[model samples]
Target: MCVMSRRGRFQRGEGRHLCNLSGPPSGGSASPGSFLPLRGIDLKKGGRVKKPGRKALVSKDPYLRLLVKTYKTLARRTSSAFNRTVLKRLLMPRRFKAPISLSKLIKHMKGRENTTAVVVGTVTGTLLYRDMMMYVSTESRRSSDSAGEDDLRVNEVPKLSVCALRITRTAQARLLKAGGEVLTFDELVARSPTGSKCTLLRGATKAREAEKHFGKAPGTPGSSTKPYVRSKGRKFEKARGRRKSCGFKV
Candidate 1:
């Protein structure tokens, strides 16, 4: 038998065979002159990148989901830019499509005869204008007798077709009473897929009081932004911003 060390070799019939090592083989590190190996992560641009949120809606309401699904299909099938716009608005947050008042609708839809007014959000009632009061008086006898006089001069409210996500009870009843129609968004989609003969309207986004305080600082020169103060008085923010005597007038 031949003496064996780290490697055990035996000669049998003029052929030499080596014994296999029990543990793992070692001592195969790269030399100093050899190129360094690159890691998987380092080979790629792996940092987080900023991007816009998903455009599609994830509403829990079944009806809204159904509407979104329908609109998505329609938007994919049809090339109408109007449908595309409606889909985008439908996916937007409720604040973006704030509720619109009937008075605003009347004002905007003026002279657009036989056209459907579409609102993506709720449709609310307005303080009855003199003209609308007359229309409301005839249909709703609950009004005071002074409102219903045959000989009295009154303005006539124009008949209109309104489409909205929701309509307040008062606005709905008034519209129906005035021979005007109240339509759901689905109905509008069915009636005018391409938004033909329709006038799309949105609420005044800047009308909110909170929006007043959103510009430059209250005391900044030439800045008309509103400030959030407890009260408006001489002791309040009226010193530096209001008069040149205190420090400097804005």
Candidate 2:
């Protein structure tokens, strides 16, 4: 028969549900009851069946119960540790989720390369630029009294056309509003007018200055001279300082 106590429900982390007392009161000589409130701990209809690591005692104190749980967890981890078999398993992390598959991507790429005969192809067509440099590789064959004199020849790689990347007007406006000043030549091509964009080499060195032309001067423009007779009030104040008013001070 299940026998639960009235005084059980130790605050969590207290005794790890370990009671200082033993099983049901019926298991003992007396009636199954306790010194505490009769709510919360439901006996298995009759009472809660005693499960593994079931409640043993109850207390409100925190530090005392924390002590018991820490020791148990420490002991479990330290036991049977540091052997070769255990070490290998511990070093490798156990994963629960499968990784994303890239094989399909590789297959698609291979199919594309076969069709185009190039490793990679871009959707945007290529663009050409002027003033770009090409290096000439000069190779000389030094014949040590042998296969005649093979003269030096210059070999150059094919002239590569550089594509200028562009930024949208909305993007440029947003960037400018965000206080972004620096932009590459390609970036300027996207947002700026052709002339302005071409002028900038690599990054934005020149910021467009705000215009200062105005229709009118800020403050009073017509007279530009001080108004007269303002000192009359000061003279009146001086005259009143000596004169007496008809009041109770008399």
Candidate 3:
């Protein structure tokens, strides 16, 4: 027969065996029909299933795996937060390792001169100023060229000592031409075991093309999110609630 306890728990007593419908009662005998005991759950351990994090490197690259191993050892040995952070970043996936350009790196390194700049991703050769000028118009480029010698300095890549996982050939050439040094992770560790006088930098996370289509639904009022339209032609998504003549716009 089932009996409700003072605590409002259902307790079924069948002969000498007791079954707890909720869980084992405190200081009470073990219930034969308790699911918690069968599932091997300990109430003392906060019984919620824990979500796991990456325990090992997912990359097939032997060098990257070795790097992770080395950092793991470093993190275990050193008390520096820098070593721990580098180890965590090194274990991240490729998409999280966003590439940083020389122009942006130069801008970030300003006022923090002579410090080793570390990036856990690729160092690209794309010039931000030149790209912006080109995107503006051909006339703007001509005007920029005719501006002055001072204006030309914006295009000049500066000499920088950078430590990164990978560096493009174009970027490497530019750095070398400007008397810069590109050091590997091992070299960086050898120089500063505790990561002293080092500047950590990361690429723009929201700069990806896919990020533009992520927020609020398209066509909603005040929504700026891009729609997953097949084409950009006029016959596409431009009708019904999109125009004043189309049965009143949304």
Candidate 4:
């Protein structure tokens, strides 16, 4: 027998019986019924499952791995934001670590002359002008072979000390030749424990030619996006929908 409760549902009662707390009262005890309501614990609410890690790192280069380990230690020990940033960048792929040229470095380091320039990628060589005891002469208008090494100029290019993951052969030579220093990651750690007096520089990311074709439809008005075409010939994409005579403008 079952008894109804005030809610009109039959809840489980004493042994071998069911109780409908909302309905009329029933017999005291009844045979054990096969049907039993599922317990509350059986139903699982929807939720987000915990994952192992935030994101997996994708890198296998031994040198990069070493740098990551070094910076990771520094990041945890000193609690410096610069070290943390460097560690994060070290774990990133090669694309994010773009190579910087010597010319750009020179331009950026103009005002911050004393501070060390740090690049997470390779550094390419650029021409450096320095003041030396070299002779210079201009050819005479009267004679073609009248020029000789005579005058000297004191114009000198400033020396730049930099730290980077990699430096080109020519760049290293030029830096060393100009009384500049090129230090590695480990060396940088030893020099500046907390990355003080350091300026981080990144390559021009949007300077790549491929970025020009990344926005808006190519043929749309006021859109400057470049279209994918084989060549710039007049007959290539200049027909039909592209011209009003053949069809409507696209």
Can you tell me which runs of candidate 3 are displaced by over 4 Å? 1-53, 128-154, 245-250
Better of 2 and 3 by TM-score: 3
Shift of residue 214 alpha carbon in model 3, Å: 1.1
Best-fitting candidate, scored by lDDT: 3
Ranked candidates, highest lDDT first: 3, 1, 4, 2
Off by over 4 Å in 2: 1-49, 52-57, 80-250
Decide which is better by TM-score, 1 or 3.
Answer: 3
Candidate 3, residue 17: CA error in Å? 17
Give the alpha-carbon lDDT of every model.
Answer: 0.73, 0.28, 0.81, 0.73
The sequence of per-residue lDDT tens digits that candidate 4 reaches over residues 162-232 is 99989999788767877989999889989998999999998876767888899997877677889999998
Question: What TM-score fits each model?
Answer: 0.69, 0.12, 0.72, 0.65
Give lDDT tens digits, candidate 1, residues 1-250: 2323434553322233323323333666545434432222222356556675458786677898888888888889988887777788888876677899887888889999589998888899756455544455454444445566322222344688999888999788767877999998889888988789999888887887888999888778888888889998868877775788988876
Ranked by lDDT, the better of candidates 2 and 4 is: 4
* Candidate 1: segments with Cα more than 4 A from true spot: 1-54, 130-155
Task: Tell me the TM-score of model 3.
Answer: 0.72
Q: Give the per-residue lDDT digits (tens) of candidate 2, residues 1-250.
A: 2223447543422222233344446655644364333223433345555654323214344542442343233335555221222222222222211121122222233323222111110112112122332432333234522556322231111211111123345333332443433243233224432222122112111221221222333223342222333465645433322335622121
Candidate 3: residue pairs that collide: none
